[model samples]
Target: MDLISSRLLFRPMEERDRRFMRRFLSDGELTRWLPVDYPCPMEQVHLHVDRRLEHWDKHGFGTFVLEEREGEGPVGYCGLEHVTETPFIDLRYGLVQSAQGRGLAFEAAMRVVTYGFHGLQLPRIFGAAMPDNKASVAVLTKVGMRPDKRFDCYGSNLFTASVDRVAFDLKAQPVTHTGIYGAHG
Candidate 1:
């Protein structure tokens, strides 16, 4: 299913998206804040893409490619996934350098988190950001997630945040059905 926000389209990651994923994963500036190593190699990129595809197959929900509503190439991705070695589901998002600082991440996240709660009926969703990545933390908070804890993963210390279905129902600005459609309908 594809999720629609006001300015972006969220389509499920496909095998064909590997090319863009390679490019997205290689951006050192962007990946620096993420848990992955920068200057990602092609093999790792392929593995990452494969895992995302497998995740969807196993869980029925995974990452979504973020594109402009008017048909620009992919700018980034956002979705829910199992946090490795943990029982919690993680809310992850990232954008190309050219697309940063435009509120696109927050928009994509709000929609995805909404879908996690309403569409998938997930009990809760979690997000993790580097302690210094204020922008990412802000996006998560703005989407109604509160600080949950701090943890180490992939050698990086991360600040985790989460929102339960009850908290989301009480705090989130309800995403209107009119603005979201495609596939899942």
Candidate 2:
């Protein structure tokens, strides 16, 4: 899906975006909170991009690369991903060092949450951040998600939270809620 949110543009990830992905993943500082290994290699970044494409084909929704409306290239990626074997759409977002300030991550994440609720008719969307990652935790909180639990994955701790369409509608503009898929909480 293609979308413009506030100051950011959201579009699907193409193979050519591997370089952008690699750039973002290469920064240990930016990729620290991710529940993955450090120093993500370029080859691994390509594989991740491939998985993102596959996710879009199978689920009709997946990661979208984000860029500033006035800017030229990818600043980060924000969207939902299926965590492991779970049937849950785990909200996720990440930005390069260049896009760290100006609240772009929050803007991009809010857009993704809105798409999941009103665009994709998702009943609920979940997200998690390492409690130590203050930046990520702040983004999740600012997007109207609240901590629900703590769990271990990949031998790391993650604080998980969720927000549903009903809550999203009540918090965001009411007109944005569309129950095309029957309401569920």
Query: In TM-score terms, which candidate is top?
Result: 1
Model 2: residue 134 alpha-carbon error in angstroms: 1.2
Error of 1 at 118 (Å): 0.6
In order, candidate lDDTs are: 0.83, 0.77
Best by lDDT: 1
Question: At residue 91, what lDDT does model 1 achieve?
Answer: 91
For model 1, residues 1-185, the per-residue Cα lDDT tens digits are: 87888778899999989999998888787798886576688889999999899999999999999998876799999999986677788898999988899888988887888788888989988888887999998998888888776433434477778899889777754545323243233
Clashing pairs in 1: none
